[model samples]
Target chain A: MDVSEQIHAELKKCGVRLAASLPDDWVAPLIRRLDADNDIRHVPVGRESEAVMVASGAFFGGVRSVAVIGNTGLLTCTGELATLNLRHQIPVFCIVSMRGSIDDHQIYQEVQGRRTIPVLQAYDFPYRVIDRPEEIGCIPDAYQWCRLQKRPFILFLTRALLKGRRWS
Target chain B: MIAKEAIRVLAAHRGDAIAVCALGVAANEWWDATKAEDCFQMHGAMGFAASFALGLALSLPNVNIWIINSDGSLCMNPGCLLTEAAQAPRNLKHFVIDNQVYQTVGAVPMVNAGRTDYAGLARAAGIASTHTIDNVPEMEKQLPRLIAGPGPTFVVLRVEPDPSHINTPPVTYEGPEMKYRFGRALEKRFGISVFNSSGY
Candidate 1:
């Protein structure tokens, strides 16, 4: 199976009954996989913040869920994440595209590549980066850890995990 | 119509529907009316309560979900209308309190306040069930039908603003306390487990 399929399996194992997403290129494939699953209710939001708030609400409704977005979109969601999730102690797991990395030639993602981790650190939001196929198995544990932490946790998918080679 | 009175009417007709309120006047007033622990009143994330309610509705398809939104909050994330329309969760009902001012912030007038037609916006976003009520009597007459109708429905309540309630406190619980109370209330009401066995 491919990376998207593997991650989808892990999410199912994590008891995720819903997913809210605004797609970025790297995470779009996984979002498609999630949408195709009939058991998981898919919410396609207009802004990244909506995904966070939606997933937070699902938690209160006894449904496990995830938010999928891009790096810049993740930055756009920090305020809502801090206020809603941090304040209420709701946990939302997010799958993000690891943009602006060495293999990512997109100049627009440069700022996010340099600053995203620090920004997450500033807020004490935990994160994990998966660069290889084998590491995808850890998602279920990370999802459980997110629930225990009572806050937003991110799993970033690197270019190597998807494309297997650098873009020219 | 006024916010408090309108909210009181809404609460009287709440039935078994669970509420998720936006922060500020809408939430404060709903707390005043219902004193419901099951209602999740947002302390922050001002505008996205609609999205929250939508999510909850989708997750709990058997339950009715109501969102008490405000005009200012509606403007902050109008895109939620599109998303709500797209999902079309029939169990969800959305109400926008059109008070023409930011009531909590000392009566500051909202931008294009009286002119912005929120019901129209929702209709444009593809919500076929939309209504605007400008008086308490009209709300009393139309509200029950609207609530019982197939959703996602959008109702715009035109009410007069009162800055005096600016100092009115939010609901008794907040932060994580509000979270636990609201979640526990749901677990009790629906017999669903919102928290893990460890009481997280």
Candidate 2:
């Protein structure tokens, strides 16, 4: 399967029935997959932090949820992750669109991109970077690790991985 | 007088009602003795208290949710009133206690000072039944009636800030654990499985 399909399958395997996101070019395919799937409730939020809050609420309501946003979105959600997620022990699966990293074309993306890993570390969040399409399948493992650790986890999706050759 | 009466009223009708309070010493005092479904002690997020309570109310429609918000905090997120009025969840009740100042932050006078009109604001926000009570007896008498009445309701309790109390230690929780516990509770209460197979 392709990265999109792989992500969908991984989320399914992880029991994620609902996913909330704000629009971002890097994760558009994944968002589209979520929208197409009738079984998954895809909620588009106004703010990235709102998406985190929605996912947190969904988790509280017995739904396993994930929030997809870009790097800047991560900045918006630092307070929620720290206050509601880290402080309150609310586990949310975060898929961060990698920007401003190696081979990144966007100039503005470098600011938060370089700070992503450190930010996650400050929150003591365990995360992984997916540079290739094959690594998409490792999502289930990452999610499992988060569940077992009982903390937030991040999956960094590089532009190449998202736009690379289809797996299927 | 106001604190004691409000607590007594809440204690008398403790069902599955969830009470949320904004950040302050008074809220901490109220939370000390009160045991409801969930006592949301909002720390940094000021105006989001009512909005968060609204989300909880929507998630658990069977239970009644109450928000004890301060006037200062309420003013910060006034848009919440419009949203509350628009959504109009009958199970949610918002109580705005107007103390006229940022009592927790050295009792500084807010810009508008003691001039906010909560009842009128509620009316403008489309809340049908709005009530204001100053004394203990009035609060005791009106609280139950308001709780029993169809809502989304707004009750503004006018009072002076208690000078004797100090700010409490901040409460924080592990996000995942709290979510899991609350999720399990919701699953048991609603009899529906929200997760797929992996048990998130």
lDDT of each: 0.92, 0.71
TM-score of each: 0.98, 0.73
- Over A1-168, each residue of candidate 1 has an lDDT whose tens digit, in order, gives 999999999999999999999999888899999999999999999999999999999998999999999999999999999999999999999999989898888899999999999999999999999999999999999999999999999999999997786643
| Candidate 2: tens digits of C-alpha lDDT, residues A16-129 | 877777767889989999989988766665567656655655555556778888888888668767766666555678898887776676788888777878888888988899
lDDT of 2 by residue, B59-120 (tens): 55677877777788778777667656765779888887777777778778866876768889
Which TM-score value belongs to model 1?
A: 0.98
What candidate 2 gets wrong by more than 4 Å, as runs, is A1-6, A32-44, A102-104, A163-168, B1-14, B20-22, B36-55, B71-91, B111-158, B167-200
**Top lDDT model:** 1
For model 1, the stretches where C-alpha displacement exceeds 4 angstroms are none
Q: Model 2: what is its DockQ?
A: 0.21
DockQ for each of the predicted structures, in order?
Answer: 0.89, 0.21
Q: Model 1 residue A24 lDDT?
A: 93
